[model samples]
Target: MTAARDDHTRWEELAAGYALSALEPADEEAFLGHLPGCEVCAELIADAREVMAGLASTAPAVEPPASLRDAIVAAATPRAGLPPSPRQPRRRETRRSRYAAVAVVAAVVLIVVLGVWNVALQLQDRGQEHRLAAAERVMACVEQPGCRAIPLAAAKGGQVPVTALVRGREVSLVADGLPPNDTTGTTYVLWQKTGAADPSPVAAFDVTRDGVAVIDAGRLTDPLGTTEWLAVSHETGREPPAAPSEPVALGTVS
Candidate 1:
């Protein structure tokens, strides 16, 4: 057949089928010959090839039954004078059927994987929330023992604020409204007042510019006994000074 140059549009339409190996051998060769020099035709061929590749990868291979092969061969063999056996039912398979199966399977797999990932992420988030709530409850119980709340307002235009819960031997310091400390070389420190005696160091903790910092304030068995004061100080390193130069806030536990 004379290949007409004007038939470029018709060929381009068939390019994808040709690239996917769905077209007859002659047509496939014709499209391939025309593809290299034609940008539009090349894009069509590429798109078709990608779809074909995806289908091939996802489709499950089904072996033709031996009986089906035998039937096909018998039907295809020419009989003397008879019209060449009508094209035997395709025993191998057609690209269209294979791709359809692949599409269904791919969709199912994508849904399952996404569903599982979303569930796992949600569970992880819930677990973290539960842990924080438990910690808050513990703080509330500690504060019930006649503990005093000392507000540590922001210093030097810093918005961060801290509140200390002081009980006899145990004092819990809760920080809120405080800008986070500089992580490079700074930490927040807690101190206890011995009244007539000098101030003693309780514990040290790190604070983010936002968020809360909770510190353990020893064990206070007696709720209404002696006087103990709590304070917050900022410093760097592990060992906090026994005496803080300035206290952000002060409160006494009855």
Candidate 2:
């Protein structure tokens, strides 16, 4: 019961900002781990996600500078811990390793969401630069081998580009131009197809506006090469929903 109470308190303090990617890496990961079983947090995340989408519509479109990747890598590289010189007075300090900084931000978006950017800016004003760097690092890793970008589209609806990174059965997916579903009892789900076998639900999520959303990376793990195309479907709340039944968008796994 204490643990549950603690989770609620934490949610009240940071859930919205966490959804906006405003927390430190550790905090963000912790929140994500807590999301699945906590319906309250899930509902809150849905609300925050909608806020993110609305901001996306008003944000500027800018290509990340070529140096951004290098900057991220440089930021993520570890440095040795050196003791203070004998001549200086020493004080205690707590530190975390650099590898911890590069866990991956998980999404690609030419248009940065203003609301999210504002939340990050608030952190910056408070001197939390390292926190915001996580997203940049994730974007940097997207250029690495195994991960590729492709468009997720439908003949009669809106579409977006997804940046996908699959390692063994796990995947890291982030999308640009993602919007949320507001229809009652309905949500968006992700499916992965293998050869001729039916597509299986790999991830499930909903968006409120137009922005970028990173579907649960853990849900992405599937037998590597066997996974063919990826599709998004609208369905009743059941996840991996027996079947997409009706696909909203589909794309080849490149």
Candidate 3:
């Protein structure tokens, strides 16, 4: 099909709908043809398609009868040009047939609802799997030899109970009663001080309002047992600082 050359504005307006596969056939064909030559249009369409693909996994899937589609179309458009309606089935015992039709409609609704519920459960299960993996890391550290449960109490304030689980270099901290703060430009920096030597910076992480943080500070430069003190400090994000500043919370590292 020959592609019509529309102006940039028109193309941009149609790009998202085409990417989402919601555009009608003629528009889809024309936009697809235009996409190859226009770099800007191609990139935006690619991004939109990716967003739609990701959204598909989260949204419930239900294919209603074709009549539903037709009804929506008929409701939106002018009625003058509509074709004559086809005759619907007429039953001799109208009362009983109406009851049967109602039963069938209820069944279809239930099936659609159950299908959506199943999809929701699957998505939730995937999320739980990730959380469980994080939890297992902490559990493994606790169960390992030379594992240390370090207390992370705030130095200058009424502290919420926080504990760091460490085995070798792997570390995960779980804290409670965390303050709700905008994490936009802030992070929790971990510090390791080996005896009197300068405190060294390790991993940086963020916590939600619920005070939950599972940071994999990665492997420590020094071996697990060598560090004398482990601490966490609230600092500006982007990158971790070189030296340990003041501690938001601190505990002995054994």
Candidate 4:
């Protein structure tokens, strides 16, 4: 009984990581080898998956920059004509190395969320210069081969040239004549609809004094063709709601 309990406990530690696709290769192989007849571990994995599915529905999806893909490829590529090392790093350095790796990973995640201007502000200390550079980047996206420029219509009244540049799953919003966020604390939040699923919140932002705002690069929850349209909602707070309040602007994605 004690041996069985210990075995179940060991598998339980790996269940969540495996479900999250975060387990190391050797551990994953062992877990898969042991899982076929292990009812206890199978039940644990199912519970972890259920929790992950629930969390994914509320979170905004983001696509990492192309530079991240290049970095990963360079790291994974083997050195030419070099023999592989037989020895691993010393155990004493493992914890420090792990922490350093985690910090780099966290910074990469921040880059995806903050976009170019904010990343330059945090890392390079260039504010206005980076904002201009980011705006230029948005303009350049329109020249790209497969980019679609979708114009949004004001829900209340008047004609504003609010455009969304969509290429693949990437999206950049450029807006003019949007009503400025006021003392009432209502901010414009972007949302996307794909097929019959509930509209997913994309980002929350405010416009400038001239009623101009640019979301340099965003990512939709679904693939480009699968997404039906995009909308901007006037949300009460900076924090995104589980569902949008009411749309102030709407655009059909084609």
In terms of lDDT, the best-performing candidate is 4
Ranking by TM-score: 3, 4, 2, 1
| Model 1 lDDT per residue over 76-186, tens place | 233468653233233222333234333433343344445656776787776566447535745676567654455555555455356655555566656654557776777
Q: Kindly list the per-residue Cα lDDT of model 2 for residues 1-254, writing each as its tens digit.
A: 43554346454334544554556667668877777777655655565466546546767434344333333334333346865323321111101111122121113222233445776677555433432343453555566666444455773665554545555566655655545676566677777888888778787777654555565456553675676787777787645567777666777864
lDDT order, best first, reads: 4, 3, 2, 1
Q: How many backbone clashes does candidate 2 have?
A: 6
**RMSD over all Cα atoms, model 4:** 19.8
Better of 2 and 3 by TM-score: 3
Instruction: Give lDDT tens digits, candidate 4, residues 1-254.
Output: 44554355445555544654656678789889888987655765665556545544644435445355334223323458898444444442333333333333444444455564455456444444545654675668768898877878887767844678788877888777676776357677889998889999887777744544576547877887887888888888776798987687888877
| Least well predicted 10-residue stretch by lDDT in candidate 3 | 69-78
In model 2, where do residues sit more than 4 Å from their true spots?
A: 1-138, 155-161
Least well predicted 10-residue stretch by lDDT in candidate 2: 90-99
Over 4 Å off in model 4, which ranges?
Answer: 1-139
lDDT of 2 at 31: 74
Question: Candidate 3 — which residues are off by over 4 angstroms?
Answer: 1-82, 85-127, 151-163, 169-184, 206-213, 223-226, 242-248
The whole-model lDDT of each prediction reads: 0.53, 0.54, 0.61, 0.64
